[model samples]
Target: MFVFWLVQLISKAIYLYTVLLVIYALLSWFPGGYQSSFGRFLAKICEPYLGLFDHLNLSFGPVNFNIAFAIIVLQLASQALVLILNRIAFMF
Candidate 1:
């Protein structure tokens, strides 16, 4: 049981870390400007995540905020919530 909980926590941590990384990449696009090929590559790789917003016909300053910050924030919150719920479940 403890091992299962540990695995769950680790997975949630990984998920939240990924969410933050995506947020950092998307946020990097606007301020000052993106000068690296890596940034462009990330943008391309992450394009599908942003595509959902495009389907909704929303835009944020030439970029899709719906998929950028919003998605990151939501995913982060979800991961956190799941972790909390798991803890509560274990406690009980």
Candidate 2:
């Protein structure tokens, strides 16, 4: 039961993080968006994780494509974690 609750908490946290990522991506469309205090704070929390895919260089002619790739990766990871957590919860 405790493990189940822990899984639920972690899942909620991941969902919130995903939402933040979406907001961060949207904010990037505005001029000097990241220069704002709130934008910087979001970058501080999100950039490192998103940076992991930076080396992939998944971009087009002039566009940097990390945000979309990062979102997809994060969604896949969340689903995988939930599956593993559910399996563990079922065993006990």
Candidate 3:
């Protein structure tokens, strides 16, 4: 039961991260920039994770590479969620 709760918590965290990543990507499409209310909202949600790649000098030649990296990380999280569910099923 404790293991089940742990997996549930992890799944929620992963889902939140994935939602934030999607919001950030959508915000990137606006030409007005991240200063807008919606942009700021997304920035507030995404910055901590996105900031990690900011210092790396990573780029896709003017495109925001950070979003791509975040999506990849989220993808990994998704795979992890599937694996965890599979384990829980097997355990029962």
Candidate 4:
């Protein structure tokens, strides 16, 4: 039961991170948006994770799809974590 609770907690944390990423991306639209204090705070929180996909150049003309890969990776990681936790719980 504790493991299941942990699973849910971790899942929500991942989702919250994803939301933060989205917000950070949206903030990039305005001139000097990311330069604002709030945006900088978000950047500090989001950049480390997002930097993992920096090598990917998935640009379509004006739009950059780099963060999409980051989000997908996060989702995959969350699913994998849930599977692992369930397996561990089953061992008990």
Candidate with top lDDT is 4
lDDT of 4 by residue, 1-92 (tens): 99989999999999999999899989978999998999999999999988888888888999998888888889998999999999999999
TM-score of each: 0.42, 0.90, 0.67, 0.92
Model 4 pairs in collision: none
Arranged by lDDT with the best first, the candidates are: 4, 2, 3, 1
Instruction: Kindly list the per-residue Cα lDDT of model 1 for residues 1-92, writing each as its tens digit.
Output: 66467657777766765665565556565764344665565666565656555666557686645655556665776667767767767786
lDDT of 3 by residue, 1-92 (tens): 77667777777887787887787787667787677987888778788877877876657688767678767877796777868776977788
Better of 2 and 3 by TM-score: 2
Q: What is the lDDT of residue 24 in candidate 2?
A: 94
**Prediction RMSDs, each to the true structure:** 5.0, 1.2, 3.2, 1.1
Q: lDDT values of the candidates?
A: 0.62, 0.89, 0.76, 0.92
Minimum summed lDDT over a 10-residue window in model 4 is located at: 49-58
Candidate 2's TM-score reads 0.90
Candidate 1 clashing pairs, residues 3+ apart or interchain: none
Candidate number achieving the greatest TM-score relative to the actual structure: 4
Collision pairs in model 3: none
Q: Indicate whether candidate 1 or candidate 2 has the larger TM-score.
A: 2
Compare candidates 1 and 4 on TM-score and give the better one: 4
Worst 10 residues of 3 by lDDT: 56-65
Two-way lDDT contest, 2 vs 3, winner: 2
